[model samples]
Target chain A: MLKMTFARKVIAAAACAAALIAPAQAEEKTYRLKLAETWPTNFGTFSEPAREMAKLAEEMSNGRLQITIDTANKHKSPLGVFDMVRAGQYDLGHSASYYWKGKVPNTLYFTTMPFGMTAVEQYGWFYYGGGMELMQKVYEPLGLISVPGGNTGVQMGGWFRKEINSVEDLQGLKMRIPGFAGEVLAKLGASPTNIPPGELYTSLERGTIDALEWIGPAMDLRMGFHKIAPYYYTGWHEPATELQFLINKRTMDKLPEDLQKILLTAMKVSAYDMTINSHHVSAENWVTMTDEYPNIQVKSFPPEVMGAIKQANDELLEEAAAADPLAKEILTSQADYLKQIRVWTDIADRAYLNSMAE
Target chain B: MLKMTFARKVIAAAACAAALIAPAQAEEKTYRLKLAETWPTNFGTFSEPAREMAKLAEEMSNGRLQITIDTANKHKSPLGVFDMVRAGQYDLGHSASYYWKGKVPNTLYFTTMPFGMTAVEQYGWFYYGGGMELMQKVYEPLGLISVPGGNTGVQMGGWFRKEINSVEDLQGLKMRIPGFAGEVLAKLGASPTNIPPGELYTSLERGTIDALEWIGPAMDLRMGFHKIAPYYYTGWHEPATELQFLINKRTMDKLPEDLQKILLTAMKVSAYDMTINSHHVSAENWVTMTDEYPNIQVKSFPPEVMGAIKQANDELLEEAAAADPLAKEILTSQADYLKQIRVWTDIADRAYLNSMAE
Candidate 1:
């Protein structure tokens, strides 16, 4: 019995040493996630966040977290991203939240309202303010999580052949503006149409459409719209068009805590990266446009015109609030936040820009 | 021989099973690092980036990369951060890069400059334009790695007891402004003084100082400057002041790849987070200040005053450029980038803000 006890002690000691000797990597598991992005392959800034996030996640986790991304061209479903992510067909999704508004009405407020808060203000609302919590409240029940993917900072109002000097000019104005802004403009007697991207340039040039609001210079410069439409109006709608990143809750829960942190941190940093990239790209592209086509005239709608558009927007928002409690809650939160935050913006950013403008 | 072989197999199997059964965490080693920050303990936005970065590194690495921070109060070295990190006394540091300009003259360009870019534009420069490479060119040779820590969005010009209507108004005016900005004002005949923060309120109140610029409303509101100084001028200097994170190169190299990535990602995300946080804090604080003291007036230096200050600034920059080749490279990069980017800002953000303003 004494001999057996001594042998047992030796075996236990050997086993403990063996456990310590085993390489840490051998015992750890690698987690693989699949991401589906709304942008087509090589979609420039729009396609960068997910690709960068995936790369960061992989590198940060030392290849422990591997993410594979499929662009819209591969999936043939840019707008179907929300459904795919929610149903667990895709572990992650990169798209806009408002694209899901047809299925989930409250999703509309999460992207950008006609005259909503700008990128930094909206980001402030998301991370520090109550925006993240509110966003979660909408996505949690759907078994998905959504985060701010990227920002297209203050999209241009549109490229117009003729100046919009008054609200009267908007009557029977055929323009290519989509979604909520289009709805708002529709109320102002402008005929808003959603033509596919390929047809936009010719339509505007041939008078099928008088104006079109593509993205800012980053994406729009490639479309050659500045050549045809010389009057470039500044933004009122889609002030800060923040794209959305969607995660399947089950897939997220499956990751180890370290990998989870790596994934989330990557998402956040990449989102911020894309915001800066958008600004950089637009800045570069704008210079190119101005250098080649010096005839481009920058214009803002007159106050009466702006006031009328804003009134129509407010009325639409009121109707949205009346229809749903969740929508009202989000709209109220944004309105209250915008009211408080815009004062500082006026005092800090606006005052600084105006003072320094040439 | 057969009996001996079976006994050996049993022992080997037991060892392998034990190795598999042992906890994964126990075998991993925790790498601890110490960070020293220039800000005193509990300093609001200035101190938050390092604290948040440390927290994130720990959480993301699952207690593997543990960082302990020593604030200015604890270490008694507010300005000695660069020296401490370089000498390996502290593995990490949180401070502004411009703080080290006395030691490394080229370091002044990284934080902010008079009439430079705004927060988003500067962010665009840092991450997208060649700013990061240029920044590293100044830091890498010193055995330290630096990354952006945080940003204070467009600092207010200052709180003045009286308005500056012309260049003559700045003559002999005692103001609490520091760094290159002080030099610019000094060249313009203003007396720029560096007063201790605690004494600033008394100094301004008793006419010991004519005006002072601490920060935006976020920090300024708590100092009770609003009640005393009625004319709050908008910023012309330190637009998008970027704080910096420093790491000892040896310490960074010693870290495992995963831990290295974890630390960097934490630094980046926390930096961006603080930028949003600054905006949020200022917005909230601005509201508080207005509610309590509606007498505070937001003002800007007049065109003649601004023109003089800008001329002084340009002359000083020219001198710095002539003195150092590296300074020339950095200045040229910033000037060229700003020239391109500010045009986009005018068309997008400025136009949007101006159009929407009441």
Candidate 2:
């Protein structure tokens, strides 16, 4: 009986040892991921989403996968998020795809087309309508894997210093705008200048430019544009603008499979959170601007201006198709998809809106 | 062995019956839900969100939950969603809480407030900041249960006919607007008209309204507002407008747990999805508006017009607060929250936008 008891004890100890050894061998290797987003350290939507992504990653990884986020312009230039990730200078980046339109013209499909799909449709195109695949195609060329960072839903047209009466008014106006629309603005006789956020106020205030269009009231109001520009505009042009977080393909490929999944999941969560944050932030700013800073004026643009811009946009689109083959492909395919969805949304979406309007 | 097999067969048959019976029982309990909405059927965002809610309820319940969406005007009247829900005439409502400022003044905290929180922040407030609970408190008196149905993110101010050079331009202009901003417009000397989306085109065309403001390019394009109005303005005043789905408290309490969950989940999903869809739809429409519409004009409100509106908003806020205690509470709380988050978003959101502009 004594011998049996001793043997049992030894066997039990060995079993425990085996349990520990097995998990160690089978357990995925651990890693530390440091993400550097272009957002300023203080920007809530931009900074918080990255932080949320990191938090989710940590939770999903159970501390095995640790991701530290540098939200401010810490590691690289704010606009260099894509380039840094592409050049393998950073492990990840979160910024708008339209920002890198020069690098990947087709990428605008993933970010936004001038007045393209809403946030929902963009995600649909990305997830179901070959949008993600097409987006990958664009990102692959730049050695990056693009993930949806966040969506601003339907954006206002933008803020303006002066009222745009007609397309003729846009002509010769020094405006700060970007993306394909910026090019179109240029063609319409407006001098489109691409200025960074930090410079917008000073530039507008200093009279370096006559007009500037930024996100919507949420962002613009917080940035204190109301104090300088005095005119806040709509966001009809961009509509649903998507911000992207580009992860270096090689770096992402090297990550453990579970870690990769965590990265993607966390990003999506952050994206949703950021979008919600943006909505509230803009609202608060608008109220403050109007109520406290009555010196600022908030108003809309005229139909004549919209029409002229629309006409110029057609010329720009044709020119884009003519200039770039990828643009043509995206334009054609997107147009087809839009036509199909439009019919349904028009019937379903339009009818509902009309009912509510009454 | 024979006896065991027979018993097993009986058990299997019973299980199948139980499964079948469950659905049958659910099907027998029919529910007719009346939805009160702020918009008429013509607006996509307003109509689509509600349509989705109804569709989702029907599909999820396998057609047991029958929802009838009453256009804002049909059931009660415009700006009657909360009241109708409270009165038990409507089972559900889709509109902004801000529109019901007269009833539960704090209800505006749930919807988009000027310079308050973005859609994301509003979601956070509702979900995390006890905003939903607070919102429920405000609505409980009216017998309503409100959930976020949709958001337009940021919106355009309005379309203008002439150039606004200063605050003076706001005087004597008949503008179709909505929400609290309308009150501000009244103070600014502009005649504020709350024309639903369906009526905007006609009002502008007939000269009954000199200016009209509706969402951004996507919806505006579809309405052919560009044809009649000629000026497409930005959403400066109403940056991120949130839509709500108000369900009668009595009706909601009567729903089975499963059905209630489905109704809530579906509406939430639809809200996010609708926001995204609207953005995408707008983007596509913008392309058409600019390219196809020849006489259309896309312009911004002049500085002078903006200045006047901003001034009017300040006066309106003060008067509103003095006139109503609810407005004071809401405004104060919103201002506080805005101050807290602005510190972060200003850096992250603003810096990036400024960079993008460059």
Give the top-scoring candidate (lDDT).
Answer: 1
Candidate 1 lDDT: 0.89
The superposed Cα distance between candidate 1 and the true structure at residue B347, in angstroms, equals: 0.6
DockQ, Cα level, model 2:
0.05
| Stretches of candidate 1 exceeding 4 Å from the true structure | A1-26, B1-27
Q: Please give, for residues A238-335, the per-residue lDDT of candidate 1 as tens digits.
A: 99999988999999998866678788899999999999999999999998999999989989999999999999999999999999898899899999
Each candidate's DockQ score against the native complex? 0.44, 0.05
List model 1 lDDT by residue over B245-301, tens digit each: 999999999987778988999999999999999999999999899899998898988
The sequence of per-residue lDDT tens digits that candidate 2 reaches over residues A252-357 is 8887543565576567657866766666665555666677777765444565666566677767777778898877877776767765554434333332222222
Q: What is chain B's TM-score across the candidates, in the order shown?
A: 0.93, 0.80
| Top candidate, metric DockQ | 1
Interface RMSD of candidate 2, in Å, is 17.4
The lDDT per prediction is 0.89, 0.65
